[model samples]
Structures are given as structure tokens and as C-alpha cells.
Target: MMDAREGRRVAGQRAEGVAARYLQSRGVRILKRNVHSRGGELDLIGMDQEVLVFFEVRYRGSGSLTGGAESIGYHKQQRLLKAAAFYLHRHSLWNHPSRIDVVAIAPGITSQYRVQWIKDAIQASP
Candidate 1:
């Protein structure tokens, strides 16, 4: 039997798959998934045309009160910034056009899942 943690992990993976397909349909070429840096884990990384996009995939069940996007608090944003920075520096793409995107997922009435792609969702500190 799967514990709650494991169940959640599986659900998250499913959500990430959905997000990746949705993004690909929109012309995003996914470079990697579940990339972990010293700071944190990046759910998905892709190129949206010339822009390097770092995606954070968030999933919320139908019963959940807080939506997926709402769950990304300030602290989470900071961690994502750090992770994205590490990736950019490591790849020597620090000066390249890049942005953080959020893929918010939830159960849908008409489809399997509803996906919202928020571009330039996280702004780094100056």
C-alpha cells in the first residue's frame, strides 16, 4: 500500500506529465524534468522559442481549499529563484534570456486536468 507521501508523489508526477504535454502542444521544447540543484528541485525546464524557461509544477487535488498557484508562497518563490540561478550558472547561460514559469494543475470537469501556464511568474531580486 502506498503511504500518503508516496501517493502524493505519484500524483505530482502525473501532474508534471500533463503539464509537459500541455507545454509541448504550445511549442515548448522540454529540456529536463525533476532537476535538483543545491537550492531546490525544478519541476521542468524547457525552451519557449529563444527563452529559457524554468517551470515549477504545482498540483492541488479537487478537495483542496488552496489552489496550486496560491500554494507557492514567498519562501517557495525564493527557493525557485535560487534553483533557477544555480541551473543558469552551471550551464553558462546566465546572460541568456530566461524566466520562471508556473504550471498550476487541478482536476477539471471537462478534461482530465486543468492547466494554467503563468509565464515570468517569478521575478529575481536585483
Candidate 2:
């Protein structure tokens, strides 16, 4: 039997895979998956045309109280931003346009999972 942590990790990997395929079908070229840095981790990194995209993949089971997107609270967003910045600095892509996107996955009626892609979902406060 799989332990709770292992089960959750597997589920998250599956969701990230699904999100990657879904994005690829929509013209986003995936660059990397599970990018970890000192700051934080980026679930998926891709290019949407000329812009670099940092994707945060969130999955929620059918019985969960909170939706997938809603679970990304303030601290989570800050971490994502920090991670994205670290990625940019490491790659020297500061001049390149970039945005943070969220891919929320939930149980679907017809499909095994339903995906909601929110482009530029989180922005840095000015």
C-alpha cells in the first residue's frame, strides 16, 4: 500500500503531466518540469509564443473543500514569484517578457480530469 505522502506525490506528478500535455496542445512549448531552486520550485516552465511562462499546477480531489486555484494563497504566490525571479536571474532572461500561469485540475464529468488554464493569473505588485 502506498503511504499518504507517496500517494500525494504520485497524484501531483500525474496532474503536472496532464497539465503539460494540455498546454502543449494549446501551443505552449514546455521547457522544463519540476524546476527547483534555492528560492522555490516551479511546476512547469514553458514559452507561450514570445513570452516565458511559469506555471503552477494545482490539483484538488472531488471531495476537497477548496478548489485547486483557491488553494494558492498569498504566501504560495509570493514563493512562486520568488522562484520565477530566481529562474530568470539564473537564465539571464530578465529582458524577456514573462508571466505566471496557473493550471487548476479537478474531477471532471466526462473526462477523468478537467483543466482550467488561467493565463497571467498572478502578477507582481508594483
Candidate 3:
């Protein structure tokens, strides 16, 4: 019997998996998933052709008040930015083009899930 937290975690993992598959179908080659750094955890890391992409997979159940992408507040965005920076520096890939993307998932009527892939969804402060 999974507790509420565990159940949520499992569901989140499933959502990520679904998002990964969806992205792959659209030509995103996933390199990693659930990557953790000192700043925060990155949901997915992949390459879209020549660019490196850091994907944030957000899943909102049918009953949730906030939508998937809408749930990410300013603080969360900052953490994601920092995590992406850490990843880039660690891999010495600063020269490569990179951007943060969001894969927002929600319950769908006609399909199992509604997925919206927003490109370059997060940007660092100038």
C-alpha cells in the first residue's frame, strides 16, 4: 500500500515517462531524466537537433486548481535556472546552445494525457 506521497511520486514518474515518450516522438533525443544538482532537480535533459534542452515536466491532475505550466512560480523558475547552469558547467558544455523547456501534462478527454511542449520557457535574468 503506497502512502499519499509515494503514490504522488509514482504518478509523477509516470507523467515524466509519458512526457519523455511524447518528446521523443517529436524528435527530442533524451539524454537523462531526474537529474539532481545543488540548486534543484532537472526533470529531463535532452538534445533537440543541435541545441541542448533542459525540460521541466509538470503534471497536473484533473482536479488541480492550477495547470501544469502555471504551477511553476518565480522561485521554482530560479531554481531551474540554477540547476541548468550547474549542469552546463559540470559538463563543460557552456559553448553549446541551451535552453529550458517545459513539458506541461494534464488529463485529457480524447486522449490519455494532454501534452504541451513549450520551447525556451525559462530564461535567465540579464
Candidate 4:
């Protein structure tokens, strides 16, 4: 049997995959995933026309936003913002319109996981 930690990791990965598929289905062009820099790490990055979106993928076993979206507290938001800035500057996309978004996935027993997309989820200066 897998350990609790491993199980959680697997679940999180599944959630991220779901988030990726969901975004792709919505016609958001994916740019990158798990981008790492000196500032921080960004879970996913995508483009929606002129807007460059930085996404944070989260998973909870409940059907509410409380589990995943709420997990992105203020500090986490700050880090994500900084990370987005780093990514933009590195890729010379600083002039592009950019925003932060959250994709919350909640696993279920008999049904597929639920996903919620929050556009412009965080407001912090780059």
C-alpha cells in the first residue's frame, strides 16, 4: 500500500492533470507548469488571447472552495505574484496583460472530481 504522503502526492498530481485538461478545454493555451525561479514557484502558466495567466492548482477532497481555493492564503498569494513577475521578466512578457487564477479540484467517491476556476483570483502588484 502507498503511504499517506505518497497517496496525497498522487492525488495532487491527478488534480493538476484535471486542472490542465479543464483549462485546455476552455481554450486557454498552456505555457508552462511548475515554473521555478528565485522568487518562487508557479503551478501553471497559460495564455488567453492577450492575457497571460498564472494559475495555482489546488486539490481538496471536499466539494467546496474552502478546501482548495481558500488554501491560497495571503502569503501564498504574495509568493505566486512574485513568481509570476519573475517568469514574465525572464520570458520578456512584462508588457503583456497578466493575471492570477486558481483551479480548485475536489476528489469524490462515486463521481469525477469537481473543478472551480477563479479568474483574477489574486490582486497584487507585479
Tell me the spans in candidate 3 whose CA falls farther than 4 Å from its real position. Answer: none
TM-score of each: 0.97, 0.98, 0.98, 0.87
lDDT of 2 at 62: 94
Arrange candidates by lDDT, highest first: which order?
Answer: 2, 3, 1, 4
lDDT of 2 by residue, 1-126 (tens): 999999999999999999999999999999999999987999999999999999999999999999889999999999999999999999999999999999999999999999999999999999
lDDT of each: 0.95, 0.97, 0.96, 0.86
lDDT of 1: 0.95
Off by over 4 Å in 1: none
The clash tally of candidate 4 reads 0
Query: Regarding lDDT, does 3 or 4 come out ahead?
Result: 3
Best of the candidates, lDDT: 2
State, as a TM-score between 0 and 1, how close model 1 is to the true structure.
0.97
Q: What's the lDDT of the predicted structure labeled candidate 3?
A: 0.96
For 1-126, candidate 3 gives per-residue lDDT tens digits of 999999999999999999999999999999999999898999999999999999999999999999999999999999999999999999999999999999999999999999999999999989
Superposition TM-score, candidate 4 onto the true structure: 0.87
Ranking by TM-score: 2, 3, 1, 4
lDDT of 2 at 43: 99
For 1-126, candidate 4 gives per-residue lDDT tens digits of: 999999988887787789999999999999887788988988788987879999999998754547788888888988988898888888898888999999988875676877889999998853
Worst 10 residues of 2 by lDDT: 38-47
Better of 1 and 4 by TM-score: 1
The regions of model 4 sitting more than 4 angstroms off are: 63-65, 108-110
In the predicted model 2, the residue pairs found to clash are: none
Between prediction 1 and prediction 2, the one with superior TM-score is 2
